[model samples]
Target: MKGRILLVEDDETFRSFLQTVLEEAGHDVLMASDGLSGARLIKGQQFDLVVSDLKMPGKSGLELFRDAMRDADPPRFIFLTAFGTVEEAVGAMKDGAFDFLTKPLEDPDALVRVVDRALEGLQRSRDYLALKESEAGGLPPEELIFAGSAMQPIRKLVHNVAGTTANVLIYGESGTGKELVARTIHLLSPRGGGAFVPLNCAAIPENLLESELFGHEKGAFTGAVQARLGKFELAKGGTIFLDEIGEMPVALQAKLLRVLQERVFERVGGGKEIRADVRVIAATNRDLAEEVAEKRFREDLFYRLNVFPVNLPPLRERRDIIPLLTEYFIRRFCRLVGKKLKGIESEALRAMKAYTWPGNIRELQNVVERAVILAQDTVRAVNLPDALVGAGGPAAAGRDKLKMVERDLIVQALEQHGGNRRQAAEELGMSRRTLQYKLKEFGLLG
Candidate 1:
């Protein structure tokens, strides 16, 4: 039950005292003096929990909690307050703070008990996020919803090899849910009770990617103030989904191949070897064989990871499932956004069916969510993007026409959202980074 924790308190003596107690209880503790300092650390690092004083210099604990909530996955927060601010602390808890404690600790064991409870809850949350469907009685409903004939064999293959411990490599384009396939395998495997840690090889920088996979000891680098566990360590006795594996740097590929061969790795700067008892599931959109021929990826590593391959067909190839996916996304988004939508109109559905999805399932989900948000009771053609209207397919138009349509949609979405890039991107069913790139390409962002 050991976890990394962050403690924030203005009282220097009390901070040291609490750190001692937590560390003695087998928790890795990081300390900050005040709310501002704690906020800075929270933004830069990931922690299991945050313990901070409700009232401190500069920002308050509540403000820090709000900022932390901006992250896609945020740590639990526990606020400490004096008797005079009990009401304020309760308000913070109602606003989604994990728990609250009063000042002047009488029972030392109370802190230990609270910390234990918080970490236990966090473990459950992490497991739930990773194994939402598989942990349930069986595979998730979405996995079964692919009723198309093309998906029947893929579904059978998932069931056939899911219970094994062999490494898996999934080949598919972006948005085809490679991670979903990996999760299904893990959930059905013997390691379902353990963690399912996913790392995007392309998302992280090359300089830090090694430490992220293998971890680092204290003073391993300039910012290495404390020892940290890596994704492999966290995923011990479970599955590690190495997403976009083809994008991993060539230097790191050698180390990864070593892990597959030896089942061991060393910390970034530490000489001690650690055991890795985890199953690896890698996914890529690129033809790794071609990359190997080009000498961009290690040939040994490619063969090691491709022990059992699963290929996912693109959305256009499985067009029969579009309606099913569209319906699924509509229900999900309506419940998520509290819209109470019925369904997409016939015209909209026809247009959607005709348009070849360039971004595949991910783009479809985004479009459906946006349509749900903009709809009254039923989604209509107006809710969809211009390119999707009266389309034979995405590829039917030339590259220039597609670009013009995309630019127009981006401009309209931006204007509708009053120039808020985040909202505009969300509406367009794309990432903020993608939106920025498009804006730059179209000369829209002045």
Candidate 2:
């Protein structure tokens, strides 16, 4: 979507170049040379996002952000800094900058993409703000689909607690928008302006999770050829959302607790301690209280993170939200695949309502996205996976519940044809676009 942009910089040539580039991308551009003038323009204007040079004649970007936020609605700021001044830029990001670009600006394309992303962020916040005010209460809970009385208490809870910088422990079934809630907290909190880094504890191997969180010095391990910065250092003053915190190994739990308490961690095989002022937001599908009582999880760390607890009900529990979620996913996935199907058919909706989603919202999203991708024309119940089609097939939809799994047998034939879609399609008993579309659909986009 197109939106307004304000660039605050002292250099005339750079300012002119940016304005021209941004305008060509279909954005309305506004410019200011110094911080004082920039502040005045920002306070008076309704900009989607702001890009400003860090160092200026009068006030700096930091001063401008401080002043601009005084207004009820302040545009998100992106700082511009030089290469040697990255430290200052990081400080700005921690202070509330959306994302920063370094000078001399090398990648015009990257800059445009960053601006677009920032604009999308602005739109989401604006939408959430409007929805929270217009609706019964605050914005809907993360990964939660429902309506009416059931959502009010959760909405009020989310709104009341989001402002605090305390460590938050979220309890929810898998795919319940735990990360989304973590993100909403970051978006609405004092640390909302900083980076919101996320890590899946279950995804990472136990041996690697520590190094991933705390970084590693060069040659610390067999494959350690470079000194790598960890997630905590990268997040700094923002937030680190540890998804599936319960899955973390028992040994690493001690270190994670120390980091949570002291905000300090040592790189793998390094002596120096790195202090991060970052906020901790941990989420788990398992019952941490049970884990604590069973002596599996560290009581200290659990307490530290459990300062503010937010629990999200499973999709089945929040039955009211199913319709909303179904519509949202259909629209979202259709857009992703470059399709324009209207809404779900009544039969499809009925099938979805009847299914018990064990994998929860994520499972629902994948099913909808895959159904859209597989559908020949508009969405229909017949287009869904075979497992989802017949109640006799499976107990419930397994993961995505694909109707057909593409075997390596067909893929082998396709490769034997030297990447010729026509030959592959003829051999595989399909059309060229159908084969080509499958390849493209499976992330083989070229």
- TM-score, one value per model: 0.60, 0.59
Where model 2 places Cα greater than 4 Å from the true spot, the runs are: 1-149, 390-446
Report the C-alpha displacement of residue 130, candidate 1, in angstroms: 7.9
**How much lDDT does each candidate structure score?**
0.85, 0.78
Question: Which candidate's lDDT is highest?
Answer: 1
lDDT of 2 at 298: 86
Model 1 stretches with alpha carbons more than 4 Å out: 1-146, 393-446
User: Residue pairs in steric clash, candidate 2?
Assistant: 145-321, 146-321
Model 1: per-residue lDDT, tens digit, 1-446? 77899999999998999898889999999999999999999999989999889898898888899899989989988888899999998988898788888898777678888888998887766555656554243233545434688878887887778778788999887887787788877766667667889999999999999999999999999999999999999999999999999989999999999999999999998998899999999999877886797798999999999999998877878889898888878887877788887798999999999887868888998898889989998999999988788475555567558789899999899899998877999998999768865774575745
Candidate with maximal TM-score: 1
